[model samples]
Target: MTEQYLGLPIGPADTAFGLMAEYDADQHLNKVSLIAGAYRDENGQPWVLPSVKEAKARLAQDQNHEYLGIAGSPALINVAQSLTFGSNMTKNLDKSIASIQTVSGTGANHMAAHFLARHLRPKRVYIPSPTWINHQTIWAGVGIHIEEYPYYSAETRGVDLEGMLSVFETTAEERDVVVLQACAHNPTGVDLTHEQWARVAEVMKRKKLYVLFDSAYQGFATGDVNGDAWSIRYFVEQLIFNGEPDHPGLCVAQSFSKNFGLYGERVGVLHLVVPRHLAAQGARSELLGLARAEYSNPPRYGASIVETVLGNEELKGQWLRDLDTMSSRIKSMRRELRRRLESKETPGDWSVLESQIGMFSYTALSQKQVTRLREEFHIYLLPSGRVSICGLNEKNVEYVASAFREVIGFNSN
Candidate 1:
């Protein structure tokens, strides 16, 4: 009784954030950080996109601090909706799509969990085996029984699609919620092939599972926004317009954090889509109610920057080019790392380094090896051997690769 009433136990710190804090205090001149999903410039510094810089300059001439509406900026949402579904695609959606701007992707995801846990009330929610560190934390807060589906296979170094689909067919029930990464999957950068995506969609549509797409990486993945969003678009066409009206709906939690480099400004949108036969206005109103109870309103500065850039033709073109520049740099770094590792004859198959996409790579280095790298070599990366590829640049690429060879070099366990 005394223990119950006294005080709560201290919770564990978030692994990524904790490691980031440790990195900041290390003070080692040669220390390299492969933590944090945030983007870094060629000089290993935080980058403000050219489009964002122009938008900020525009705002300086006419700046004001004011609260956005409960649902956030209308212009921003419209542009966001277009970027996600494409103008032509959204035109076909018409009244079936309901959207609201949120604090960011985390907020969008949290809001989705809360709203779905209360209303949709699924019997279970299925998440990937290894995912963003916060996925389980967010769902646990909503009081839903969570299940895991096999996502990656360390043996094949690729997606375990058969294992994933088998679980869905065997254990997953109707109306169960399935969380999916829209593009550039986190931790492990493995994603499904087009045919693989179609297979999963077929199983999902047949089973009537509600899909919650986490669209944190859109244009950032392949520098082609339309190509990155193909899965979501395909699913909508197959499930909503083609499936039953009674089929549970799907939602997309879109983030501008990566694509627009608006990480700090916290700009995101959640779009809930119902079957073509149903009206979404009622659902939209309820979402507004949920938002009102939460942050009261979303941020203003980031939304303005994104809207200004996307709403204009020239600025939008510049933004597209910016995506290409960032993605190209990451890809180049990947190739260099893999080449250097192979040239030096480092241990395992280093080809995966080049194949994985986006900001992170899941180096097969074990936890013990990762610890040795941090302790002996002054390098920083997640214990799971995940590294932010953006952390590598021209100056330090060889040093980092050499460090890898020293730690797990040639035929050593």
Candidate 2:
């Protein structure tokens, strides 16, 4: 095709999405797809949570097809904020939080980059080396000088807490932004313990570096909302509330796509929080302006469903159970895979599979091993060897383990 635009270079297809397409085209009957981050049922199908189904049914009565204001639904913002910070802190931190409903987690992250790159004007923004694939692309689009700090150590198969703190202590400057995954870290499911978080918080407070918390999996991580949010809340108490006067404050980009199982609905919120001495009204207005320029308002239906589920007591109970159901199944898959791999004496330490939390597991499988899994066994996962634990179920866990045994070779660990 002739160039439709003057100076546009051909871009490669998105890695994850392109691979998903390849998985879709494969005709193998026993094909297992551990590619997507989405949740699947025991039957290996997309699940609509019972709570969400009920919420949709309730929405069947009162529905409106109107354009939400530039800032989107006010109700969603309130519930989202409450869910993020919990009710007490939401009230305690009264005038210090600037929150706006967003297109989704991606939209919230994008808006944050847009606002911060222009206003805070940090010399460098640091991200984890093996974070969500979109983190790099999203920040890059906003034209920020991006730096990657060490996060996961492949040799240890754990958090590189010291390395992470060293970067913040030495290289990071005041007002420099640090992106932190609140819990259930993507690709590599390793999350820092409370002590580890506290150590990092000490460095961040001393350095006066700004924080941007990306909370994509709340209750979805461990079936406990508060447990998953412990890191963020700890940072809130340590950095903003009790830190030095020069503390730059922090923001949270909360996503409802996973926890609420409303992925396509695209419901999320960005919360910009300042110290009690600072006011957030001006920041809220600025966020409104950014929202106005890009995608004006967030989707209403998803927000409404989430709001309904969270607002009603019985539905909220159902939602909690749903969270447990999803998380429990992912955990089970992890155990089953580990049990099978170890029972067969697969090479290396298979214990990491059970130890890593949430949807993904960094199997540390080599690129060549991953390729062989796809080509020979019709199994699909990221080239980085990140496997979606949700993809395995009673039906395919043994198959996946056997495939791993073949690629990795058999050895006692």
Candidate 3:
């Protein structure tokens, strides 16, 4: 008898990172990359928030390479809790919430999936159809049944509220998990309006669904951290605060990568909030156990940097301004792209460019059009038509617009 040890099928390269590799290998002089979700400045360079720079300067004198606890930095968790749920809510949620630091939003999501798969054992997990590619990958690891509910309406370039709610009402059973992007949904950039949020909350409350709110773009969405958090807060209020006792509470997977410009640092927090009458101490212990087995300890340097900026009033203010700077630039580029396309009489509705918020947009370009832009124009974007608005800048935006016009079969006179 023979035993086979190490034979495995090769897997395809990650679409985004694979394209990133191609973009990097490219030596084209006028090449433009609308690929990664990281923010880029007007000059199309990676930008570090001024607050983060200052925080690093301060930490450089006193920072150590010591390992954080398995659950990560408590100080960072404290500030992150306050950031996501606001200070008052953080205080009020004392007995009801279990929070731990994670590798990043990805780790938080992974932890939630693993924890729920073991503990809550939901029958299925529902995610937006065109969500961040990683969402599906993360859930699949936990061996849960994953389904995609309709999300963005291509016809209207908006949230498919009716379609989403119909699935929730008809198909979703109690304790089933639903992954909701807290703000500025990835790929599509479309968010539920406040009224729409309330409707979903009512259904979730009624259906007794467990929610995993992915809070990746809090301040980065519109530069107003509080405003971006409205959905999470509202859901907490509706589903947890005012709902029935049997309702399995919601959790938020918060990330510091985008808002703090600490992408490479891999800092994030996972908050599991239970009902008011229940204590989250047991769940907290389980999360800590999972964290201990997975990574041992979260990174210390990034947590210090985050805590430093968020803990101090002056640095936090500067961070807010930095958010404004990044968000405003993204908005302006959206306008510029739309203007250029419209002025050139490009095909289809370009107004979605301006209406969509945050770093990426569901561009609606077909795979063929996307390929043509890459081959002919040296422009790189996801084949699914998701483009990182951050990649557009003053120098390359017009070129990108023209590439779109050409690839979409529009040739202006």
Candidate 4:
């Protein structure tokens, strides 16, 4: 056997496993856990939305074991369409939109990237500089070149909007694909204001660029579905109102993990808004073909639960209420963390934490400080100092704030 086959190379997982084993054996391991993803309840436990439980109950009584089509559950797909594009989206129901269920957000991204690589043939896909770590890996895995656009500015702890627009304006026409976070941006929790989104849409339209929206936290972001969907809805509206029937724009990847509290279930949708000129049946057939080769069909359990909740008025209302509860808790945690940090008179402006929305806060700590936070303080977070705000509660917010202050405070001296 060749050397490559004889000895497989170590990957990130091996490195992570080794590092975690050492930490597991160390004393004082309970200080903090450094997981960057995954939503936790106030008690630092995995959460299952109450609406999901009720939906599961309804599905269990007369559930069919029959295999879903390669494109996944039709009812689930319909519900997904309605949830993202709105119930009254004329273009959506008119067959101008093509949607397929996928394993989850990551899967949806992969599917879209593959399609773009094969069909769109853009020079490269431009992703945010500090986007979800998996984004680069996913695009590159499909043999597509990946480039970075300015996103988070560490100094200001906010978006580098001007820098971002500059890159987009100079991008060669029809040669770039820009991936946008549809709602709450991950890792930083910072989001674009309505005005900023409008500006971005206008620039992209003028440049004739393609857009791929990753909406991982739609309802979870603000507990208001329409509020979270404002950017995407505006994009679609722009295309329709402009009467550009053949506009070469608009694709969306939506995840049910965060909002539905269905993390491990791997449920998501990949949709494309095709030109009105294309035969509706033809567009749907093409999208389904893509799904046929990728995963054959998405799992039914999660999709069934989603459809059950969303298709029923009472269950949908219940789901919204549950989402509000989750959003409220995270909002309270942000305020409390800000209050605690301010009380300590932390050197830098910690006000950004309060201004930023969503489940995380980019704490702006250097990699060295982040290391100390983990090694000495047992406070777990990404090396970039992004903390899952959902992990904080009445019990741990003060402790986390104090640890943060101590690290930064000592560093300043």
Candidate 5:
């Protein structure tokens, strides 16, 4: 009886973090870590943006530690809103938008799941198959019925747009929740083209499905912040601004981690947009209630830093340069890795490396090859062969490419 009450099964460790621990323990000098989604400089070191450094300097003179409101810093939320939706849309949103500050991208996602699961109470939530690993776990934790729609195509090494839209047209119901990564899709860097996005939006609008846009990599994905946010803006214009009244609205979970290099700061905001005629005050209140009960308030310093940078014209310009620096480096590394791999006559198509945008690529390496790369070469990536392009630097790109060739060229199974 006591055993029954006290015993609970221990869950498996998180794959990325667990592997990170293993990599840390390995004593190999040339060991390379391609596991994390975080950015790394050409020297394979975590970088602090110049804009961030300046913001900290400004805050240091008058820095004060105090608990923020449950909704977080209004300044940060304002800038964040403008960042995600652009100025015109933010102005037009007016009363229909409900905004709140959360722990980070993860917290924003969890809050959205909790609020929607309780209030919207949809029949099922549709997530992309092989989405960010956390998507499934977040919705599942909220006790929502989860369904996976096709996302990527292994055959073409691109977004499986037809299959994804098919699922929406055939299976999804009105008011059902669908998760969409706004830009720089995690795991697989492939994103839907503008035409493909319009198609998906049309089907979603017709089906009256609720969209939860995960805007984790807005400015960070490409150098252009506005371009990165094209999908979300397009969706709002079609679904909310010009959409039906009865149609359930959408929400955005925005993170500043990758964009601002504030991963540890845990700064994020959640925006809930109701239908055209509906005011979001009630929904905003409910969100505040949930936020108050959970973590009380969001972090202060990080939000302050972000607000400082974005609010200032000079600092914001510097921040834009910072985005270019990170994105350009990732792009160059991708090209180099592809070039090296092809020059050695590695089997399979390596073009995907250059074609795919953002920090990650679906290398299409088998599970056996992944293991061999780790055990033999001490290079680490996810089991699904998703490698973080940020992990490849000037020093390690050749080594990583050579390892790939050795693993694929040998096939010692």
Candidate 6:
């Protein structure tokens, strides 16, 4: 196999399907010049939040470079639990929750998937049809069967709630894990209302299904940390009342990359909420064993930054303000994009752009239209018609909107 595969060796300098295949010879990096992810700034440069800079300064001045434990800094973990579950959360304070530091949201997700696949032996894990691109890959990599439930409706450019409920009610009984985006639904940006979340909780409770909530954007979604956490908190409350003693499986994967402006830091936490009866020493031992085999232990720097910010009251307050600023910018972009598209009377409905909330908007553009935007207009976006709202700002919003209008309208003509 090696001989045959190696014989067809293509050097790294070539492009594999569009993604750069190799680093540049001069800079030891790829030559492609495109906004890599949804990240952006007014000047098209990366913008670090002022609050994060201050926190980093404080951390750097302190001479604590010691390695954190496998479970991570207890202070950070406690703050994380509080932020997600709320300050007055009865469940969190009860000490029944067990959390471990992870590389990031993706890493936390992968860890949860592996744990479920090995320990629970669930038949399959159900994910949203239009979930994050890496969701399928991460779960499938751990030997877990991946199944999709209805999510986006192309005609309406919104969620197919009825269709989603139908799938969950029927298929949940056979699945071991059901993955949910706690706040901001990625790519589409359509979130379930509080009432809708209650309905989902009901269905999951009746089915006795285990849930894994992936919260990548937390405060970055609505600019209010508590607001974004409502769904997960509600689910936790429901699980506490309904979960059986013999079986407890409610987990949360939280990311600080977006909210804390710590993307490269790769800091996040994976929390497993169990019934008080099951909170014995043995459970923690099992979790540690799983961590030891995976990545040995999570990194220290990112976790340290998180610990510092969350631990210090002043820094925590500043972080909240920064989150508000970032969220407001994304919200403004959404409005601007919608206004531009509407003023031009671009073909098709553009209401979804306004209705959807978070860092992304589902433009409802076709694959062909998206291609035209890239080839003809030099605008980059996912083929699924999703645009990162963060990619829009004062400088480029007009150009992006015009490009979108030209491609979409021209294609319709």
lDDT (C-alpha, whole model) for all candidates: 0.91, 0.91, 0.93, 0.81, 0.94, 0.77
Q: Candidate order by lDDT, highest to lowest?
A: 5, 3, 2, 1, 4, 6
lDDT tens string, model 3, 198-281? 999999999999999999999999999999999999998898779899999999999989998889999999999998888999
Give lDDT tens digits, candidate 1, residues 1-413. Answer: 45644588668898889988988999889888999898899999988899889888888876667899999999999998898888987898989999999989999999899889999999999999899977899999999999999999999989999999999999999999999998889989888999999999999999999999999989898899899999998999899978888889899999999999889999999999988899999989999999998888889999999999999899999999999988999999999999999999887898998788899889998888888888877889999989999999999999989989998963265
Tens digits of per-residue lDDT, candidate 6, 7-69, equal 787554312224322111224211222324445566655778777788788778777667777
Q: In candidate 1, how many Å is residue 9 off?
A: 0.4
Better of 3 and 5 by lDDT: 5
lDDT of 2 by residue, 39-122 (tens): 999999999999999999999987598988888888888888888888898898889898999988999999898899988889
TM-score of each: 0.98, 0.98, 0.97, 0.93, 0.98, 0.90
**Which stretches of model 3 miss by more than 4 angstroms?**
1-5, 410-413
Off by over 4 Å in 5: 1-5
Residue lDDT tens for model 5, 143-214: 999999999999999999999998989889999999999998898999999999999999888889999999
The per-residue C-alpha lDDT of model 5 at residue 26 equals 94
**What local lDDT does model 1 show for residue 385?**
89
Question: Candidate 2 or 4, higher lDDT?
Answer: 2
Which candidate, 2 or 3, has the higher lDDT? 3
Q: Give each model's clash number.
A: 0, 0, 0, 1, 0, 1
Using lDDT, give the best candidate's number. 5
